[model samples]
Target chain A: MRRFHISRLIMLVAVVAACSKKPPPAPPPAPAPAPTVNQDSIDAARRAAEAAATRAREAAAAAAAAAAAEASRMEAARADARRKLDAAVYFDYDMDEIRADQAATLDAKVPVLNANADIRLRISGHTDERGSDEYNIALGQRRAAAVRRYLVARGVSEARMEVESFGEQRPAMQGMDESAWSRNRRAEFTLTAGGNPIRVP
Target chain B: MIAGSFTRGQPRGLDDGRAVAVRSYSAALTSFWLVCVLWGLRPSVLPAQDPVASGVRIGLTYDRSGKPGVALTPVVGANADSVRLILGRDLDFSDRLTVIAPDSGDAPVGGLNYVLYARMNAVAVVQAAVTPSGGLHVSVHDVAGKRVISVIDVPLPEPALSPDWRHAVHVVSDSIELAVLGQRGISSSRVMFVRGNEIWSVDADGEGLRVVPGTVDGLSPAWSAAGNMIAYNTLPGAGGPSKIVVRDVLTGRSWSTRAAATNMNPAFSPDGGQLVFAAGTDGFDLYSVAPFTSDEPKRLTARKGSLNSSPTFSPDGRKIAYTSGILGHPEVYIVDADGSNADLLTSSGFGDQLYRSNPSWSPDGRLVAFQSRINGKFQLFTISVRDKSARQLTSEGENEDPSWAADGRHLVFVSTRTGTKQLWVMDMESSRARQLTHGGKVQNPAWSPRLDFSRQY
Candidate 1:
């Protein structure tokens, strides 16, 4: 395609030069005498023009292939981000220990952290109100640390993570009974996005 | 089933409908009071009397230093005499304990079984210069619990030094007894109540009677968790709404939080960070104070036309149980610290007919104590926090505004048994009660936390 564009520009320039309304190129051209119109020369000229057009066509095809490849690469990058954003790990009531089923979730998040070197994360630990305040605060801290440990062990930088314990102060479900408490006991990971907590002390 | 001991067989006549209703109501009241007493104590058998050797064992320990110093010292002078008498009193009080005084000039007092140690510390001396406003500036506790457990700082006039010294000495001596024995000295605390239009407080032994002297008639005196202030409701004028005021017990400085003019029954959070009270602009609902300043209180309960009142926090300050009439009648409801997850906890059949109000949590958070009206009389009761079992505590007369002592072993309440309302404290386990206020109609007594008598506050 690039070759084609160059040839088109050359042909247009040649035609304009030949069709110039300038005075005839001095009589020196006549003195040279009219050479015989050789059929071989005309055939050679036609073959040369055809070869250049073929090169131009090949260049256009190459350029289109490169553009398509770039677009596909961008699309794949977008899909991988969406998958990471959808990753969420849940916990059981009064339990800070990770479950066997959550192993898959941790595995999936590992690569996302690896790819995004600048990403920082915060692990917010929470608990249900079944125990004393002092005990629950400790429980929340443990849960948050548990999640942080998993991520760090999977090669996510420990410096990129921060942990906070909400205890039972903030609940996912506000109910008086056991069911409500069960919902509140959880650890959530929030991506720091541009706010790189890792760079902070 | 333990039957008579645990459950008293639903009053009497259950087959006849009218008698069943009447008896059921009374039985419910009985259940309420039983719960109150049980939650108040829920007795457990003592550890089988510890195999007594046909007698008793006495232990004695005291501080012998008369001055503020870091190191331990030997007993001497007047402190030696007081320590001896204090040990004698303990031995005399317990028939099981026999006093065995150490032999004089004993060989270095080596390896004595349960050594009777004593220290006469001069750190007990405290000077309280009365503030211009009658407040006291006491900078006396040069030594806290680490120095000595017997003596603490108390405010007294200079001329009464002799009696004050003896009284202060006794206070320390009693504290030593408590520290060694896992009980209280009960000598340095005071109990406050309302009589007619006056607020009054007396010592634990009911001596040193004095009026608190405040404007307006008062009711429901609640102690701040720190024991530095008392909050109560008072009607400033006839036909006016009641106002809740927190008074500095020592300084006489006071501040009031205005509710809907009908607000009352204010209780402090376990940490003294918030005050929970009932205020109904539409109908009474529970509220909290942020920053816990005496000036402003933040409303917590949703104003949904439900009569929510009498808010009290659990021992650890996680949950609050209050009385609400959302189910067409007043029943106790427990909610989280921030007024979420509200669940109705009480269901006596007489809730609609007779109001159930004044909910207080036991110190251990195992049960809730409240007052329920039955047969036209309000009586104290306890509801089990786990199984919702109701137990009644009083049978003689109208009993209400029950407050649990810090130990959760006893309750102080108001009863009209003596032809008028008077303060009464009862040991829930022993079925024994004694009138605390004798002369006037005393109501709304708040029990303070265990006194830290090791140092002057």
Candidate 2:
């Protein structure tokens, strides 16, 4: 793992250097030659070694700063993702039709849509393991569409919502009973931005 | 145009229906013409005189005559059209069994040389009167075995439950395909992928496509070996830090674990109990998750000065293959499950032959499929696990993310050969190629387990 860390550190340094967009020119020619005794040359070599050690310390400091900056940027990205997860609207048992209450919940997510202009919403439809797989899929789709239609009608662009049904393959909870299933049969959300970062919540 | 040489029938009224059906078939020819025009030709069936192959091909007949049928009456015509198109596409995609269009006269009736007949009597209960079921059963004659295969009543889901009969057709076709091929069909399996920044599951043939919960803008979706759960790297911040999520697709519920910002390509162990992914604050290394309830993951790699990423598990779950640059350039390496005994699989240095990543083992555990760059473009390639001899599978365009089919005889990889990144399957034996989907640049096609072949109607 140390080797991995070192490689990453090197890559990080390279990335920072690349981003800075500056290249140092070749070093100036050494000062004009002067007669130097062996003792004087040894003293000059010792000073050069000390200076090299100082440069290493500075490089380490730069690396630590870069890492902290990266961490903060990642955290900010995560916060944006958490907001989408919080924006999801849930449904009551086994029904794909959105309840009147969901309208208010769905309306809450509009600001997120408005904020991320390129963001797209994936409305995943799911079902508890109660019904047949076929029935569950259709039901799941209906639920997803209900959520999608609501968002689109609320002025979220139609292009923003893509619906998918998991049928009974994925569930919020695993059990044969109803309580566990209530959480399973609902539509949830996924957000994608800039065609690169895709967040599932 | 097989209309020219029809033998005259006794009833002129029936003859008119035939003529009108034929002429209306011409005027009402619909998109079948367009399909014909599009392909200019469809692969014709093997010659009638061709000797029978190893498998049994069963014919299907649906009783379009009841209340259930009445409800389906309007969409019946459109549904049938789509079913035909889907069948054409599926048969073309698979190499195991061929789907033959219904011959003249009543389908599955006598005079059809097919060894087995399947009738779709009800959407909920498909009753086939084969001999193996004894009193009114659907009989399967395995000419090779010269005996009847097992026959039992199969209960189907209700018609109303099916999204049109197209799903039923694909499902039944898949069943017939399995029964005949003696191998599983991909019908029941689901393909998980990231689309429009979300993880989605569509039918194996790409029908009934829909996104899954918590999959929006997700990346690197990996299926558990048992094919139950999916793990992927979510865009930072649905929960915790940039994390890996394990989703129970059936329940629509999921949980997340922290990973580095660059963490991607999450792969599950064969048993589905644990996962290995890339992690690190600056340099990424392999990390293992187990005692899954624990919030902290055990770091698995400690190679101090190299970049390690894209960890994929071997089928036995005993070893992991990942890309590492500790040797001065990126190459594939294998390590033990507990993270010891690291072995370099590729000795390519900072040269053209080096720089390989994303190692995925074949289902049988013999070969590893991955992508390597040549002439500055990534292309799909396979390396024999035993000898490490590499063979490039694609050449014309940028091809990457190759996954072996369940049969292990074909591979599906994303390619930009057609001007868009589309999934294409390559038959290993014949080297023939066919595109699986159109529109939407698709990637990462993971073949599901061999289908449950016994679920025949």
Candidate 3:
């Protein structure tokens, strides 16, 4: 009986010693939810940085190509081709009707449009910095509508044409003169996907 | 005469109401006079004209600032002096209270010679004092009755009720104006207009000019009747097609129509309940939408093959006036709010029976103000609703986009008379037009209802 009692005391002392040592170092911390939000933001930031770098490279390449073209004599030819490829169909002052002369200009767009069916053509109308913007917008709409009607009359599908009116907002030139005013009153042909904006000023 | 001048981008023809620069060959000599003021040299203010001897006029008198014995507080005396100038200017601008130039002289001990002032057509007199506690104490006296009308003591704050003491004093001036004239004054209300790509606002006192947002191809900024919000159209870029964006002028909160393909020229209803704008997928037509929230707009006008735009609500909210290009050219048309009884307002009126657009109904609902294309110029004209008779308001320059103040006696319109297309305010009764803004082709000046300052932000 005395031997049993001593054994019990020894067991209690061992249990106390084990309990007093330390708690099992907290079940290795659960994967935090906080890092997930940070990860998404970090990924977005990295993508944005990568996109900025890509744009910088593209701009640099364009600058180099422009420099090379300037060194050569073919830059004018490139400009001329671009001008023809994206020609602007103009209208009379305060008039939206396509003049007899303007008809051929719009007709010339048919072949270019037919060649690239995938290219979306945006016909943006503008007006001289005159009158009220409300009236100008209406005039611009009529101008753009006349162009669209002409374009649709030709081989180009109406679905390919998207019309917008800047109504003296986007001016081709700036000044308080006839030269500036005339240039400002125009409808620009922008090839949204395939080509550059064809503007004549 | 220039060959190919009409080719490609140059749409050069005869000037058909699109002349940004004034073509007035006749030049007028601008005679300048050094204006002496009782206080601050308010540049925009013309020397206040003494009231005509026929009507009940009011004389404005101010407290002296540079008196030898009078001591001011820590605040500069200039601040106190500015308050007096603003009060006098506000009273004069109201036109209901025709005030002569203010003086520092107090009323004579014989009670300001009430009979003599009455004989001189002075029915009321106003006197203002700057208290030691940065307060403005204003007193209005009845000339004939020999009694005090009201004494207003505004305990001004360090920053004042608004951004300036001018706005704070305007509150008192308007109160006096209301008491004297029985008509509320819009002296403290703000006017918003489109300047270039951005929307800008200026207080009626010609102070506290600030730019509001939705600047990415913003156009046709219309002030809501609530006065705290401005609804404008933003041209499509990457955020999708043209959307009607409602911007709170005080708070930076914004609401927009979801993926609206064609929404332009947003005009709020008189109650600020429904928003009417020109929306077109196939062709233009007016549509009414819920304002300051996300809701689909119900089509208001559907004339099938015709184009309708620029819808403005009548002051009563019972009728709507809009510009409809139904007759091949835009003309002013009036219709019910539910889109019926479409009556023509402008057509075969005044000059050439040409284009008329941007119709703004007067607050009195008696006349509709619109811009008519007359003699190769878009001029402002008002048509009486009774007889459909059109009277020309402006003929000298390209004046367009007429908007009326709450008083229905003043108008703000776009003009190129002073070089660029700037906003000009004209007192319709007095025929006195003043340039409101100076630079950057400003257009579409929409005046708000008297602002509720408690809700301003």
Q: Whole-model lDDT for model 2 versus the true structure?
A: 0.56
Could you tell me the interface RMSD of model 3?
2.5
lDDT of 1 by residue, B30-69 (tens): 3543454445422232112223421243221222211111
Q: State which candidate has the highest lDDT.
A: 3
List candidate 3 segments past 4 Å from native. A1-81, A153-157, A175-182, A195-201, B1-78, B107-121, B155-157, B160-164, B213-216, B454-457
Model 1 chain B lowest lDDT segment of ten:
B15-24
Error (Å) of candidate 1 at residue B7 is: 32
lDDT of 3 by residue, B208-315 (tens): 566764465778888777786778887656766677888776776888887434578889888887888887643587888887654878888888535688888888
TM-score of chain A of each: 0.55, 0.54, 0.55
CAPRI band for model 3: incorrect
Query: What C-alpha lDDT do the candidate models reach, one value each?
Result: 0.56, 0.56, 0.67
Score candidate 2 by TM-score against the native.
0.52
Alpha-carbon TM-score of each model against the true structure:
0.46, 0.52, 0.72
Evaluate model 3: give its lDDT: 0.67
* Two-way DockQ contest, 1 vs 2, winner: 2
